[model samples]
Target: MSEDAEKIIERLAQDLRAGQFTPGSWLKQVDLQKRYGVGRAPVRKALEALAGRRLIRHEKNRGYSVHPADTEEADQVLDIRVAIETGFAEAICRNAVEADIVELGGLAAEFEKIAINGPFHLLYDANLAFHGALLGCARNPAMVALVADLRMRTSPAPASQWLDRSRIERSAQEHYDMVEAVRTSDAAGLARLIRDHILQRAD
Candidate 1:
């Protein structure tokens, strides 16, 4: 993407993540161009990027609309996440060093800290960072990329999950459990923890 188009895409994606646009509402390119103060080219490019991620749908005449929630689709993505993350955890437990566990603990702590006093976006970003850090420990670039793809269309950003502190705490505890399992090089335990952690309160 050109810098102009990338900037527009990022702003559009941020709006999508923040739930500024209602799901299933058609977004006209002309309106977007006006709203973002951009030209037609960048607006078109931005919409295309979002559509590719399935964050928005591009119908022939409809232009673009936010992707509506679908329970079955979400569940399918979550199941794929479980498979990827479980394998990621297994690899991490087998290959991780002490430094890797320490890093994971720190990332988890930062996320829990933000959860307590969150501008929900910060909390969400921290959650993403923490999970990404854990996946990094696996050292398989392919698995990391694959898990990221699984997350693209099924983000919980539109959900009210983060509004519940108890769920956040539970997720944080799961991160700690994963760290412990990795420290002990318990591959089976780590895989189980990863699966549970990814699925908990994730609707």
Candidate 2:
């Protein structure tokens, strides 16, 4: 794909992730073209790429549309996420440096600020940044990429999971605790924290 097509994919993916497009809503090529101010070719390629990612569904006679929320499938994918993300705990602890810890702390702080009053999409973006930085401490690019894709596969509107204010607040605190775990080289503690965060089993 061309660079423009790739950029379009990311932009459309962001919109999907942010819940701007309702689940099961058709993504028309002309509408996408108008929204992104791009050509039909790029929109078509972007929609195809998103469909391949399972972020959207493709029909034989129809074009692409957002996948409807599936609780069972989302739960199954969340299990996979818990396994892979928690598995990264030891590597993340071993490889994380003081600078990385500080960066994570900053990201956590940013998330907390956003969680208090920011829009859902911004809060989601902050959450992603925190987790992305935390995972990057593992220094495993493949794991990071795979986990990211799995996250998108969990639900068509992942940001909808943050709709509860109390849950969002707890998540903000969890981010800080995760940073502390990395700072202290607490792999076991980090693993447990990650598992709880992913499963939302933390109190």
Candidate 3:
């Protein structure tokens, strides 16, 4: 993506995170043109990109609408992720090197800092990096690709409703535990930690 396109995507993602757009509401190109102060091309590109990720739906003549945040579907996605990632942790246990652990530790520290800070966009990026590093440790190209795609498709809901110091702290603790589990080559422990972490809110 060009720099301009990247900026548009980031802006749109931030708007989504800030609840500037509601689920199932149509996003007219002309409206976006006025809101974003951009021409049709960039707005069109952003909408198409989001639609491709299933974050938005594009109809033949209806333009684009924000995809509904279906909690049930989110739960199912979490379930599949837990199963695959748990198995991935086992693989990491068998193959991870010292460097991998060190990198993971650094990512965890970053997450902690974000937890202490108020801006969630940084936290979101760090969280993605931390997990992407774990998936990398699995050393399976296909799995890495699949997980990356899933990560984009499963972008977490806006943290606006869920953002609190206590929640951030708890999330940081989860990251710490995950890093320790990976460092100790505790595959089963890592698997359980991930599963519980993902499902915590579902409870």
Leading candidate by TM-score = 2
Considering TM-score, where higher is better, how would the candidates rank from best to worst? 2, 1, 3
- As for lDDT, the candidate ahead, 1 or 3, is 1
Off by over 4 Å in 3: 1-20, 33-42, 117-121, 140-163, 201-203
What is the alpha-carbon RMSD of candidate 3 to the true structure? Answer: 3.7
Candidate 2 residue-wise lDDT at 1: 27
Candidate 2 versus the native: TM-score? 0.88
Instruction: Single out the weakest 10-residue window by summed lDDT for candidate 3.
Output: 152-161
Return the lDDT, model 3, position 46. 88
- Please estimate how well model 1 matches the true structure, expressed as its whole-model Cα lDDT: 0.77
| Candidate 2: stretches off by over 4 Å | 1-3, 117-121, 155-159, 201-203
Cα misplacement distance, residue 160 of candidate 1 (Å): 2.2
lDDT measured at residue 149 in model 1 versus the true structure, 0 to 100:
54
- State which candidate, 2 or 3, has the greater TM-score: 2
The C-alpha TM-scores of every prediction are 0.85, 0.88, 0.74
Clashes of each: 0, 0, 0
Supply candidate 1's per-residue lDDT for 202.
39
Look at candidate 2 and tell me the lDDT of residue 134.
96
Estimate, for each residue in 1-203, the C-alpha lDDT of model 3 and write its tens digit: 23476688678866764456776689999998778888889999988987786656799887998656655665676677777878788998777899998998898888888778746667766777787887788899888766654544344354532456787788778888887888888898988887886666411
